[model samples]
Target chain A: MKKLQIIALIFSILFAIIIVQSCKSTSNITESKFGAQLWGENCIRCHNTPSPETFSDTEWDVAVMHMRVRANLTESEAVKIADFLKTAN
Target chain B: MAFGQLYKITKEISNQVNIHKMKNLIILILSFFLILLMNQNVKAQDIQSTDEIQKLKQEIELLSKQNNSYKPGKSQFLLRGYAHSGLQTNNNGFSFVGGSFNPLLIYKQSDRLLFETELEMELVGSAVELGIEYANISYLLSKNITIRAGKMLVPFGIFVPNLHPAWINKFPTAPLGAGHEGILPTNDIGVEIRGGSYLGNLKVNYSFFAVNGGQLNDGMEEPEEAGIIHHGIFPDNNNGKTIGSRIGIFPFSNSSMELGFSAMYGKTGARESDVEDIKALHYAFDISYVKTLSSMSSVLDLKAQYTGVNVSDANYPEHDDPDELYTFDNKSKTWFAQLSLRPALVENPIVRNLEFAIRYSDLLTPEGAEWHVNQSQTDVGINYWFDWRTVVKFSYRIRSGFEGGHSEEPSHGGVEEDGGNSFFIHWAIGF
Candidate 1:
């Protein structure tokens, strides 16, 4: 009986750990591996999390122009950022 | 003992996972609440820009008007008056304490019609003037047009008929004697048509009338010809009554441009002036523009005009001589360019609608034109809009050169010199 109980406890503990792990990543919908990696390196430093509604469509249009001048963000990187922000919300 | 230990281990692990989930849950809820607060702020700002508050204010005004109406079986009457007094000085040393009162009386007859009349009094010359500033039965032709006739203020150029000095401009005075010259005619006996279309941005106006051309009582003064007394109001002048017409267009809201031309000729002349029946032609062009500069946080408005008057030689009906000894030709022109700048466009509790402006004008007259003079007046002033329809103005003005020499008025009792210092205040209202 003692041995059986130990085995059951071990299985339950492992199950709980797996559930927490699944939930941790459940809401992080940055699905594209390349997009997520790029965001990790470029965006996460400035912002804790990316959200779309931070800037209006027109505001984003102006911001992109400013970023190009100041940050020298490449066209592809800008496109990636725009897509992420547009969908983040 | 081993089974009990295993149970304890399982329970501890479950508690740990639950606490972790609670922490994450709290973070998510807090973040959402923060976002919601931010969104509310953004929405409030959007509402302000859309002028929703103005709509509410208009509704309040309408309600107040209804509440103030007379009870059934009685006539409703309203009296509103405005007054102002100010001490002002200019860099050129012209200064004074001057003011004006423009009070209006209104009678309401249901929603279809209203009667209105205004009287004006000025401190300069301590002038007291009374007239039916606007007295016409306005027949609502349609939502787009109103036809009115009677002794009506002539609907001419944007400013000629609407020059209250107090309401439309910043300067306590007006464009180069525009206020005092009494050069421009005011009210006339005529029919006027006025209305709006194009989404309330464009206004169309027209008028036709016959009037006692030089009725000083009507706030209009006609120039006197040499040897001809009261040339403008004499019975002979009206026996050959003069006719005039005007058309005005406001292509956009807050901007109006008008071009007007009037010609009157008849056997009208002062007695014995036989003054051959005289024909006179007058043409005036006025253009005004207003712009809202969001980038500069200011508003700029410009107004300009050019006018010319030609009088033909008259034949003496009483004189048998082939040539009359007294014959003169007269022509006059005036031009003005003005700029107004109002910073801090938004109104606050302390600072209201305040504008600073400058104007340069040159008025030209025939070297020997009857009752005319050539002079240039430059003015700088500030307009403080106390309310929607009330404003206080302070201006400093300088005038120079009676172009041809001394002004014709100098030959009379009028003052003629390089210039003189003048200061004044005015109060105005419109419904």
Candidate 2:
């Protein structure tokens, strides 16, 4: 079991490195992209991410605020998400 | 000479009376003209007031338009839902289960007002049970505060509010002691004040709520052996209200780690006469850490939580005979740890969205209980995310201690026995 776990860990690390290199080489990450990326990365872990156009600016503010506490999101991350959602529509 | 004098007197009297009548007619005509002039003046005043009202209406309409323009987006209505179905096998046999159809509705009534509701329908055997998961209206009081009222998921722990949704839950089943019959209440009808604020490098988030308290249930035949205290979702049986609060802090600016603490306290008794006011207190501490390895293109998430509940000096009196009473240890504790790794950082498109997760949970009942009440479980799962809102999950769960029976009676049925193992596969989607 220990050997298997170690092997799994090593394999994961190698795959991660390759993925990161591929991502860095492919795209330019902007603030909006970063926000969207985080939204896709974190928000989707537990549920589907709602469309930014699904809510108005004020509504997004409230929704993000509620989710921040519920999901244990950082203030900056929540703000970025809020900004993305506001502009997404 | 006498006839001519009489005719002169008659003509003089007639002339005087005619002159008086003419004077009276002139005065009556003048009075009618004065009344008409007064009515014209009143009509002029009415017209002036009507013009003022019209101007006010126009101003109000203009103000409304301005308000609408100031709002950045139009009101939104969203409908989202998920369905879960699976098969499980244990010591009994393999059985097909119809899990649930959960529908959520969110309406943005205005810039400051929002209404959201979720309904859950789960198939238990052949019968379907419907439950309102949460139905609440929230109003933004300010930038940093909001007030919500109605039925809401209890905010006591991280799992209930954050990971309870089928699409988001990493594993097929909930953690031990985190379910509805766990140590703490899962949902409550209440009013809550919640928001987030920044203090220095740390972001603080908080929720404080008051809800209907718990209730006491004792079996009619075996009052002493079956008596148990648990959460109540319906109206309060007594005046006492449960107060719960959770506060979390993220010290890092990058949103990587968070620590939170939650507590609830209230009396749980139907009436003063049935039992001494059984005051229930619950506490939980939780932590979550997430890190993205830029080099590996992988994200790692670690989470853990510890929760406990204590009932103060509980005494159960026999329903038929109040004189006969019994007491039991009214304490319960539970904890869980979980780890998840997403290989999305991998360059391979096929494996990028796949995630592997493992979790362990333990639950304990108070000492000197009527039945054995210690349980531990381990689960390993894999999730494939088609999108943020859609997922396919498969998990293997190994459960020890306690078989199929009532949660209240730990000694009944398969007490102190292995619960066997099961495997489940579910597809969840939300839009």
Candidate 3:
């Protein structure tokens, strides 16, 4: 009984935060060749940054999507990172 | 008259033989001269055919491009993963260990759909072992949501999916309680809804899933492996599905820090059995902070997580006597905290590549269970970076518990029973 209550409470709080915060925030989408910045910020969080030349454009497509899921990146961020790798390469 | 006839026949025979020899010698000489003339003729023709050869090369290049164009463009395939080879000395003896090749395959069917698979191959003793860590397909539903199904890593904590890779982990070995017998679940079979968005200044992401929860080991087949839950196994033991989620909150604009919370609720005991209604609640909290201190010319990484499982009261068979049923407060708890420091901006190349890390972890299982124990471990480690995705790690560990690193003996135990006071040297590479 206590366990259920605790889980319910946690979920409720999480939902409340999502509702309140989402309303206060502006969309976080900007397209300014920001792939370089996205690549640096997310890659460094867990491991070192990989070079743009490390993968081909097609490989980067798959690689960035894998990272998108593993690191919880938005689809927009994933696409921008992919575009940067393609352009840089 | 006979003698005269014989002499005449002999002369005729000799003349014929001489004629035959002359014809043979003439043919041999003519054949040799013919070969020599052909060789020179071929050489002269080659020198005159350079333009033809160039035209042929151009044709070949065109054909190559045509072949490349015929390849399918809608689908893409990628092979990437990590591998490690190293040596170690546990309390039992000095030996070579830690050899594995983990490969991940991702095949994109369209812009929003992909199939991913990860295979783990390890060198164990004299044989090679193979396993499928996860095989799943995901579809991007929208900006804030994606759907995935099949076997995948449980979102119980950050370590399993994100930080357990050899090249990414600062230490050579895993934290004490993160292993096979640990409180955290590694993988599960389920459907998941995963995504996140920027909320104000905060970046929040979550993975919510429903899985056939892990099974409660009954100590039937292996006593040492009993009393605990076995994760990612096949064939559901019960109809109840476990519902779980992991939510990560990144408070900083630069995403330097992440705080995570995870919760799982489901029935684990076998259905149509004595303890079908008994359920388990698992929860975890994790935090990671990383920063580059310009003044100190160094980088610091700090990580910590706490995880526990609460199983409702149930009667389980005792390890010693199968007929004897025993019950206790069924719960398992584990926690680990680690810090890593590296002079990433130092002028000296050698100094800049060196990293130092220390960690403390504790594991506490149900007291009366076969795998029960109150244990603690401390590890000090150093690593030399070869590049962004390669490193050589050296670490030493100290163990203290009622039986030290041994989690067995009472029966149905987990982890290496003899791995106490260990030393490790590992080389990890990611590609």
What TM-score would each prediction reach against the true structure? Answer: 0.55, 0.71, 0.82
Number of clashing pairs per prediction, in order: 1, 5, 6
Clashing pairs in 3: B223-B412, B224-B411, B224-B412, B224-B413, B225-B412, B226-B412
- Give the candidates in order of TM-score, highest first: 3, 2, 1
Best by TM-score: 3
Give the Cα error of residue B260 in candidate 1, in Å: 6.9
| Local distance difference test, each candidate | 0.47, 0.69, 0.80
The worst-scoring run of ten residues by lDDT in candidate 1 chain A lies at A22-31
User: Candidate 3: how close is chain B to the reference, as a TM-score?
Assistant: 0.80
Looking at model 2 chain B, report the run of 10 residues with the lowest lDDT sum.
B409-418
Q: Which of the numbered candidates is closest to the native, going by highest lDDT?
A: 3
Question: What is the lDDT for B369 in model 1?
Answer: 35
Model 1 residue B406 distance off true place after TM-score fit, in angstroms = 8.9
User: Model 1, residue B271: displacement in angstroms?
Assistant: 7.5
Which lDDT value does model 2 have at B151? 89
